[model samples]
Target chain A: MTALPMEAEILTRREESPGLFTLHLRLTDSAAQQAYRFRPGQFNMLYLYGVGEVPISIVSDPREARHIGHTIRAVGRVTRGLERLRPGDRLGLRGPFGNGWPLGDCEQRDVIVVTGGLGCAPVTGAVQYLMRRRERFGHVNIVQGVKHADDLLWREQYECWDRMPDTTVLIAADEAGPLWPWHVGRVTDLFDRLRFDPAQAIVLCCGPEGMMLAVAEQLQERGIAAERIWLSLERNMQCGIGLCGHCQLGPKFVCRDGPVFSWREIAPLLRVRGR
Target chain B: MATDCTLVAELRFLAAADRQRLIEALREAGYAVHGPRVQEGVIRYAPVERIEDLPRGWRDIQEPGRYRLRQTDENRLFAWAAPAASLKPLVFPPREILFHARRDADGRLRFEAADGAAPKLAVLGVRACDLAGLYLQDRHFLQGAHPDEAYRRRRRKLFLVAVHCAHPADTCFCAATGDGPVARYGFDLAISELEEGWLLEARSHAGQEILDALPTRAAGETQRKAAEAAFRQAAAAQRRRLPGGDLPARLGGRLDAELWQAVGRRCLACGNCTAVCPSCFCHAHVEETPLTGARTTRLRQWDSCFTAGHSLLHGRPVREDTASRYRQWLTHKLSGWHEQYGRSGCSGCGRCITWCPEGIDITAEAAAIAGEEA
Candidate 1:
């Protein structure tokens, strides 16, 4: 809640892809770290000391309260600077902000996580949450799509999830290579093989708006109620809190009201261009 | 001490010359008094010591994209509709350092929260519209579950002196917004400026103390009537009005009106309207580091929706064109604000109309979007 950033040391770092990486951070103030709690879909305003901050989803499990993980794509000014950081390098962090995915509503119901491109990071935490409490849910299905086959980052992690009982991991590439083993075409193409009872399913989605819209349409046509489908939207989230006005969409502050919202609550707004 | 019963509705009269004494009393109480003064041909809030510091014997002639101050034979303070900006900067500063991060030789990064302790400030001659704007801003920064500490620290020390408008600008529509002409709330002392002296009413306990300390007499029936008549005339004189009631709903449905495109063609996307808007709270966090890179200062500077960077996400601007930007600002101010703050964001002070280089009249634009003539 404090606007001031707290110092968090980079405990570990991993290069997920050429322009994508993950940084495991631990708050220097152990007491503050212990006090910090975040939901699966929520994000943190990660600051690169001398550079500005960027809103990145927390990829670590909420159960691991002290250790926080953020997978970042070096696509902007702040993220490009963060790419140079290594273990033991310290940065500023302020967060555990925005409404996360609706895991509580997923109890005893199928949890379908849909993502596109680098959008898998936000949902990865939720998928991990479901994996830890595997017995409580009906089924787990993760469907991800990328522009190119080589753009996929977490192949091993998806393979690990595919081995879990009552869980399905399907990945697709728009431009498939000769050696690509997954399905070809958009994430919508993988829907035919996805296993879930649409009537009793909760779809958590994050990605490009076009992809999400297509996914929502596909799910609705397949009999999933609009209210059961949730989406995490991204905007210019400068302040983790709602005070900064950049992230507003219609009446909602994407950073506060949601990074995740029910399709029924946000569907009408998605139709408007340049909102 | 007088009984508490009469404090709520009591009115006192201060002689024209005694205004300086009131400023002195506030200064003695450790408040830095700021009032409207002409600076660089525009009236803005600045430090004031004597009555002469106020923009006396001056009235602003305001129209769409135009503002000019003309000297008047009669001497009166606060005859203008509004200053170039409201009291927003006094509480939420245009630029503020949130915190500082320093790097040590051993690669240890230490962050220190900026000391946000603010000076006790007393703003004089505030208008009803400005007060309404401040009230909405208070909801934005303080009423939330996680109140902004810096804004709270500054807001807690403010001593507001409200002034009922006796002359409204042609561009003003506070009357339509239901926030102006008469000072109703959010002030320690509400003043009704008259020709001979000033009629003051205490709305808060602090206001009563200042009223008691001043060389004031109980206002006669004639003075009270004059005060009411002045405020009434001000309201009736307004040539502009922003239609209320279901405006938020009405405007929400008109987001795609081609009028926005037309307005966009003329709109410069300069953000002058937001800069002068009393309730605009958008800011950008900027990091400043020296060439040596030993320390970094993170500061939040006032930002506008018109800027392409305001809606930038992954290098893509959500509102890529001026029309969309204008739509975002107008829709948010009229409709989106109601959903967020439970009311409209505009105070209808008309600074946006007067100060915009393109002279874009929000009232006219809103009317056009609603399929009405300006």
Candidate 2:
């Protein structure tokens, strides 16, 4: 059946940072809720009634079936409109679309999560999933980079995950203030402080294209095979089912073929400008 | 081989007057027949009740950025190739309401999916290239895991009557794409317009049934031979050809080529080429709110890669410049589409060429890239 936006009521709203917030929605339709199972990196098309729809990554753990969570930054008209949403407010949702992060592909391999700025939203669910089932993976590492210390969205969540056994969290802010207690540099700069078996590690990266490219290159230099490195890419995605054709990058429809792809598959196309 | 022989043996011929009988037969069989008719100065696909609705003796002359209909002495119905409009709009409409949402008096919001019950349609006079384009569209909308219910519903009982191109247009290069001049398959019935009468070949059981009921006679060997010869002539008349051998790789490797910059300079970013393209399927969603603002209907409208909004990411357009947008369009059609859809996107109908106001010939641009080594 063709995807249609089902009515969902905002159960809770949280302001993560300046102009960045997360909305927890409970599907008003019981049938829609039962059918709306999603993987870690899959996204939902949130339709703001009378405004428009925007593709937002599902930021909550996939295990939580009752309520779905979406972290959004007010970057465009639709996102800014979403900022006005309050608890009990009604909106529309159509998704759990796009290929999610290949958690199964990690298996017993070491998992390295790398993100910059608000790019962490897509990978947060996967990180939480890994933390819940920590025994399934070898080592868990979350490496993040933001322009300023205040730009970090989920500081408390990072702190919570950092204290978990066998999990490593590394943060880097380019312009750190007195309140900042993490490493003060670019994300690539934090690679020198971390130690892991590159052969047994699978890297998951998400950020601006340039940042992801740099991170992938750094990971490749550390002897991680290109096939083991996965990156969540972003394009102008509409109709998250791949029909709209906006999120096309080379041969891949980011909505269908992937928002999550192995670095080896996208490496050649990444070199091309304006793809 | 046996089936092929039997299929050819079942070929029938219909005189020009009996064409009207065929339309009536289709109508009696519960099909709303649609064909090309000269509306204003251009030929557009519209509902047809009689043979007079077809653009008879009115052949179109099409070149890059040029389309003119002129009266020819030939009394044949399928005298010309495809008009500016192709078979796209029949399956994928320009604008379609996906669904409607409304808030009730009790403050409960209700949603209704768009009704997908479409009228039984028989699209007549579809050219070989247009037929190929329709097949590609089917692959996208119906063959996928999540088939488009609306398109699938509309296409469920649809009938295709493919007309072989007897006269190739200047902009047309379907011969090069191996999709036109003659349609090998993917049509219910394939008609070849010969000088004497129409040589109709049934490609499917439904077509065979239709042929059995229509006013028709066995096609003579001479008529069949003449039809083949006409198709050959049409193919031989094509002046443009896409580069052979791994076209996807050839075009994909030239993303940074300077040829795109040259073509982009002339592009107005008006999206005319995409609008007229038989295979381009990009679309935008529009939310229609009434004056009361209590109800909203979401509509999907045809969109183009040329628009800045099409590639917008966080208030920034990915392909901001015309050069990049043009490159994305051509490369996706010729190169990336092969990997994405397991086939080339362009059916070589050349509607994009004739309809483009800037006359940006895709074939010319592709050839330039193919000619370059790097």
Candidate 3:
């Protein structure tokens, strides 16, 4: 409900993952402070001032609120404009909007966060939250896939997760060079290797729409209920509010209603979802 | 005390000479007085410098079968609406610079949104249909999630002076959408043209003062009845009806009805329908930064959903064929708009129904969809 005009500033910028770059920003006014009140799975509109704005999910954890980090890919004009920004540059920003990942539901449940490509951005927010409260849940698992070894993001973070006592990190790629030691195939291949019971897991998945649909079906086949699997949708977010009529996936505003929703809540909308 | 059925009988009427005086007064009052004046053959919205300049002896003949500019003996400036154009571009603008990015000599970047200029426009003779269009577009632009700053700036600065329609064009269906031919809310004043001058009524404080300052009048009940009857008859004459108010909700259940493919064969996809509509407010923003770093600006251009490029992604347009695009357009107008904004996006101005290159009429289309559904 906080409606502030987007501030244009680039506090710091660097490429972190394949096709994914991170910008650590010192925003106009109290962007850092307001970011904490942001829930995981929320999004913000990044404006390149003269270029216009594009909605991006906040990749960094809300608990680490000194600055905001967005793991963005160069997609359209405005994002490409954001990617071109260097350290100390200024870019416009609005929100911390959208109903993000439901952290409260995952508190006592076994967690499985599956992600692919740059779809990892919104899930990254939830992943950070889970990492901070590591002791609260049992059987924490992360399964990731990308086009190539270079396409995988968050190398250091995944390495750290791999080393965590109760956490299991499994990654796959379509084709592998000598650098990849993990499995070779699609993300769905990793689902068969998991030993956890789906009834006890709160599954959070983000990635290509086709991949997510297939994974959701796999989870269903493994007897996982629709309510347990959450998805971060990729749709047009022109206004990042309930207006503009651009970001409608059925009746839901991906900006205000959700950038994150249960697979169940959106089953009726999927026929027209991805576009 | 005679119940004053005087329906603003004591209200002032502007003399033919007073329009010139009013424009000068508005200029003095810091408002840009814009009214309908004949340029070529049509009466268009523009600045009025003289009383004679405002469209006199002109009327617009609109129909599903036809639309044209015709001459009438009436000298009322508010005689017709929106000749094939809505007041959308004047506020949101057809093309606007939304932001700019410039890389300085040291390679530092900066972004700035264009606030644009605010002209305190006194928009004269806006009809109820276009006002509804403005409100619906506001849902698309200003009322949704984030505010469209440039749109908000121009919209907030406007001083509306509306004129009630004394008649309805065959193409006009304002009655069906509840946006009657009579000018309604968000107007500072409403002007009803009469045999002599006009029945000028003020709803806001600015309107009262403007009328108070202009050449004045006091009237009997007869003139007031005439004005009310004129509005009612004009509203009644609207030929296009959406079966009933449930047209939108009913159409929601028929998304894949064969009527879409039925109409698809004739659509040219020229997008003249969207351009002429009062409520279509889609736009796209592109960043343009020159190689010299002189300026990198984000330009917001009027975009139509009918265009293949509007829905393009990953080098593929979503609605490549005309059928899907036309379906999105009509369904959005008749259904998707209500689902999102809680109201129909169409004002039933019939601009889209008339201006099609192939004459793809929407009223006939809706009737077909409903007829087949039944």
Give the interface RMSD of each candidate: 1.3, 1.4, 4.4
Using TM-score as the yardstick, the better of models 1 and 3 is 1
- Give lDDT tens digits, candidate 2, residues B78-148: 78777878888888999999888897765567778887789999988888898888888888787766888
CAPRI band for model 1? medium
Q: Which consecutive 10 residues in model 2 chain A have the weakest lDDT in total?
A: A1-10
Roughly what TM-score does model 2 have, to 2 decimal places?
Answer: 0.96
Q: Which candidate model has the greater lDDT, 1 or 2?
A: 1
Model 3: CAPRI class:
acceptable
Scored by lDDT, the top model is 1
TM-score of each: 0.97, 0.96, 0.85
Clashes in candidate 1: how many?
A: 0
- Looking at candidate 3, what is the lDDT of residue B272? 82
> Better model by DockQ, 1 or 2?
1
- Over B1-374, each residue of candidate 3 has an lDDT whose tens digit, in order, gives 01111134355666554666666766777898777777766556778766677777777876654567877887666667556677786787777776566656764455555656788888777887888888887776767546677778788888777777776777777777777667667787777777677777888888777777777676446777887787777777766766555776666566667777778788878888877787877666556756665667666566787777665644466566777778778877887678778888788788887777676778778877766321
RMSD of 3: 4.6
User: In model 1, what lDDT does residue A259 have?
Assistant: 87
Model 3 Cα lDDT, one tens digit per residue, A17-87: 54558898656557445544577888878776555677778877687654778888887766777777787
DockQ of 1: 0.78
TM-score of chain A of each: 0.97, 0.97, 0.93
Question: To one decimal place, how large is model 2's interface RMSD in Å?
Answer: 1.4
Selected candidate, larger lDDT, 1 vs 3: 1
Model 1 Cα shift for residue A77 (angstroms): 1.9
